[model samples]
Target: MEESTNIDQCTMEQKEPRKVTKRKFRYIGDFQVSDLECPKKRRLYWNPTQKFMSSSRRKYVTLKTKIHRLKNRINYLSTLLTELTECDRKFPVPRSIDFNKQFVTVELIQGQFVPDLMNLIIRFADSSK
Candidate 1:
């Protein structure tokens, strides 16, 4: 019966995970957010490189949320991305960037960009490192 099926589904959903761990946001060592541009709705421009960011990636993560304040939310996203990809060395910066680096874009797809950008980077680090 339909009622029995519904009860079974509810019981299955009630099953919980055995353990949960807190995730922390990892900063991009030396990377910087050179620019942040949102020319239109549902569109974002994040530049982390010195030459300027282009829509060159095959896939991008887009997030939509309520805007309670007029502050630039995308700016934080850029900074978060920079922090996730930057190198920690103090001297000269690397001339080339390897997008496939272990901690760079490792698990970018598994992360969630919710009310903030920290979750995305956190998930990436968790899976890669």
Candidate 2:
């Protein structure tokens, strides 16, 4: 389970396709991470959104392997949310952010995400652009 191991040990965080693909996706094209073009390789078994992410509770995940899945899932949701919301400077800005990194440092917010706040983020992102 190298994929699982990579998620935990890797310094950066991002979502991974459930299956592998030989096609290479560039950083800034139709298949770019920002575009978040859905993978055509594997049928998307789950459409777990940020709302679902908030509900995810993986207790008893003592093994590093167990935690990897949870962390990677969250990172993917964070990226998607950022894209959908069109966040401005609100997006994570990890000091060493690179293509090889596994995790992004998204701003940590406590409590439920207010719809109003989401709207605000959208407006902010729009204005910045």
Best by TM-score: 2
Pairs that clash in candidate 1? 27-83, 28-83, 28-84
Candidate 2 — number of clashing residue pairs? Answer: 5
Clashes of each: 3, 5
Query: What lDDT, from 0 to 1, does candidate 1 have?
Result: 0.49
- Which stretches in model 2 have alpha-carbon errors above 4 Å? 1-62, 87-129
> In angstroms, how far off is 17's CA in candidate 1?
1.3
Q: List the residue pairs that clash in candidate 2.
A: 12-101, 12-102, 12-103, 13-102, 13-103
Task: Give the Cα lDDT of each candidate.
Answer: 0.49, 0.54
Choose the strongest candidate by lDDT.
2
Tens-place lDDT digits, model 1, residues 1-129: 999999999999999776877433232333324422334311222223312323323123222223423246677866766776675753453456676563444454555323246866888899997
